[model samples]
Target: MTKKNANTQALHALGQSLWVDNITRQMLDDGTLQRYIDELAITGLTSNPTIFEHAIGKSTAYDAQIAELSRAGKSGEALFFELAITDLRRAADLFKPIHAATEGVDGWASLEASPLLVDDAEGTIAAAAQLHRAAARDNIYIKIPGTAAGVKAIEASIFAGVPVNVTLLFSREQYLAAAEAYLRGIERRIAAGLDPKVESVASLFVSRWDVAVKDKLPKDRAKEKGNRLGIAIAQRCYRAYRELLAAPRWQKLAAAGAHPQRLLWASTGTKDPDAPDTLYVQALAAPDTVDTLPDKTLEAFADHGSVGAVMAPDGGDAEAVIAEHGALGIDDTALAAQLQQEGGDSFKKSWEALLKGIADKAERAGNAASKAGLA
Candidate 1:
């Protein structure tokens, strides 16, 4: 037989979970998502405002449902989330098997809280719980930004037994902050004699770092530049992740039936045309971690990607790479903060656009319903 999903299967065999960072009703209804799960070993899916905005705005797959919900008087953020929960619930059901098989380690779908709530700790906590309950699936994670307020929300959500995917973290310190929030939540649950098994993941964006610094590097050093910053940051984060799991704090939680909050690699798609399509996927391959890639990146990897040496637990050359960039006037800390803020703002813009698109679509849908004597 020909090599089918050869590279994806190879990566899966190497102990890393590959999740597609996109979702749509068409993919689920047409079985494309299922095929990815069965053939390409895609164990999970993730969604953000940007992804949902495109999936709903760019296609008619959601038209009928939008019309139905519009008739039922749902619009704005409520309408957007109604559509999102529908799609994610379907995806979560598809991944239910892997979720059960791995005992909640591998298969999971993520739905982000509204980007507007990034700075509202109390609102974020309420939103996460409500969304998780709205999704009503064990495999669904309510995504919260890993901002300071979001850290508070993360802890509160987890303590309330809602799974979370902490997004927008760009540095090792940021990742640690998210992880600490998760630990505190679990620790509280343990203290309260709760289940203490709330699942979570800290998402560290990668490609954006390289994209931010690519033009800053010297022209002659262009070829050696794109992959350095992102990979270095990821390596450092990965090292901390490994160390955190090995620490006594985590061991106590483990003994009390807690699971490690996985370190997720987000924004793995190569932003540079000159870079390898599988660059981040190949470089960040490590066990006990998750890599959420865009559909194109996943397809490119499935078609021709290869899994090479796994990332070293000791964070090989991460310090050196950061030092090199520091010498070049690139403050990794400052850049990390900038990237996190920019990511939040970009998603907010997308969320607003998506809501507008939904309003417009709902109006058109209502017009058609009136014309057809169905109003």
Candidate 2:
């Protein structure tokens, strides 16, 4: 499709990168991802335990690799990473042209560290380092959740020159915390005479906030009150992100070759069936940010989406929207905390299930090999 015919191309023209949040070996081997890059201007992708779980559990695409790895005595997390890293490396290679063309601003793929390390700061850092090294691709980002302890790991990881995608951020405050951690890492790198051009993105999750508050909102203005909270929060975070980019501190780092940490909008798929499929994707159109869409959402946008008025850096109506919710007894702080914790827990569960899926696949493969006298 030509750029004019594709709304995703229009989004790219507006300067926001379109990243597909879901990935599978089927997609990569079948050229689905390359087509996205060619036609829709998809410059990057992000991954988490849930996406990996679904990709592995639902497909035989990985069975042979799993069996081979199992035969080599790799199991559990080790086997999972081998599978993940192999897929991501291929994806990273496909995006490498864009990575070089953009000088590292776009064309990136991410692999999250084990969700089991959420509370383990030191372990998180070590795992991030190991994963980045093991992946051995500069275009890949090692994802770390933006939890309190994760913030510490983010700083250390960035200082060590590991490109990071800071994930699971919920609100403006959480986004700022991730930004702070990223900035400190950049600043330390500058001081230590290291390259301050480390790449990072603070991923503020949208859509989930709306899902969380929809049932709790007043019925009278529920249309106005529901589903819009996430956009408002995202706009507010965007305002903060713009402010940080303009700060003297950031400017100083910029002078020393540091790149601003771009704000990424995650969870852009609309959870409410009543809402438009492209709600978050269209609403979050802005320059210097990212909107990571699910495959269905990406296709919907490509088919029928239009760019809306870009978010006001001054946070147009975001404060009022949030304050109105606050007046309705929606505690933003409490809810953000709960969301972050729940997000971590959810990922941990997915990680466990992913391991179980791999184990099952390996066992079945072993059984089939023995039956065929091939073991």
Candidate 3:
């Protein structure tokens, strides 16, 4: 590996698992995903409807399978999951050695449950369990949003032994709620004599916090506070994560052989053009956490990113920074709710587009197969 790639390895050495936030069948086929693991220390990955929309809509890498599945009488959500699970299973196998080496602490891939189920706790629960079983891979997580309904589903899913990646969280409170769900599930499992080691991660989205408030900052201090909200929020959440791990409740779980649900930093890519490309990656480095970087952010960091001081376990200056933002009329609590709702809405859009894209591709593939007398 070049010195540039070693920079990324150094961050991994600091105890945070580097996970790529995007996946494409092209990457898997062309060896790009494996290259990331071998050279840049990426141990895991996470995917969303937006990523899948772009991947399938823009590339022909999945064309053959789409055509075959189309001919086999599959379409819509069923067809989509078939495609997604195939890619996730391949990625999971690639990470299997790391999964074994780390004893399941690292080396995992995530597939999000249907965004349409964001408001249906029962539906989300069933979909998460179904997806996990369909993937049939021990190292894969079925992502469930951390919305209120999703929180309910999360507890049930965890109890059902479905590994979960809690997504779309935007604040400490949201993170705590998700963490509580995980705890409750594990506690129930231990009570029922089941293994307490069901794996999980609560993903707090960092950069979107800044993006939502960038224009709302006071004009005089915009330069000082422009991109600070996200990091401050992450610091606050990191402190909560550290505290939870040390709490008596979690201690009991640990004693019962349960693994603490790791806190994951998601949406870490910088959105402001004026900010450093590696802004989130550099600032959110913390031990026992996962940072899922977008492709551009991962490549930028691997090429030139430097790991600054890891996040303070006590959340140094986080409250003060948040207080300053509050003085500017930015209510972090309300904004967190808004962001979560907006994220769900956004994912719903992507999910619709992804299904439509798949349907359109399948149609064209079927038509072509018909013309060729192969259907």
Candidate 2 has its poorest 10 consecutive residues by lDDT at 1-10
- The lDDT of each candidate is 0.92, 0.92, 0.94
Q: Which pairs clash in model 3?
A: none
List the candidates' TM-scores in order. Answer: 0.98, 0.98, 0.98
Tens-place lDDT digits, model 2, residues 1-375: 345346888889889999999899999989999888888889989889999999999999999999999989999999999999999999999999999999998999999999999988999999999999999999999999999889999999999999999999998998899899999998899889998899999899999999999889888878877888899999899999989889898898998888889999999999999999999998899999988999999989999889979989999999898999999989988999999999999999999999999999999999999999988
Clashing pairs for model 2 are none
**Which segments of model 2 are wrong by more than 4 Å?**
1-5
> Can you write out model 3's per-residue Cα lDDT over 140-163, one digit (the tens) per residue?
999999988999999999999999
Give one digit per residue, the lDDT tens place, for model 1 in 1-375.
334587898888888899999998889989889888888889998999999999999999999889999999998999989999889989999999899999988789999999999999999989888888788899999999999999999999999999999999999999999999999999999889899888898999999998899888888876766578999999999999999999999999999888899999999999988888999999999998899989899999988889889999999999999998898889999999999999999999999999999999999999998999999
Whole-model lDDT, candidate 3? Answer: 0.94
Q: Report the number of the highest-lDDT candidate.
A: 3
Deviation from native of the Cα of residue 353 in model 1, angstroms: 0.5
Error of 3 at 202 (Å): 0.5
Off by over 4 Å in 1: 1-4
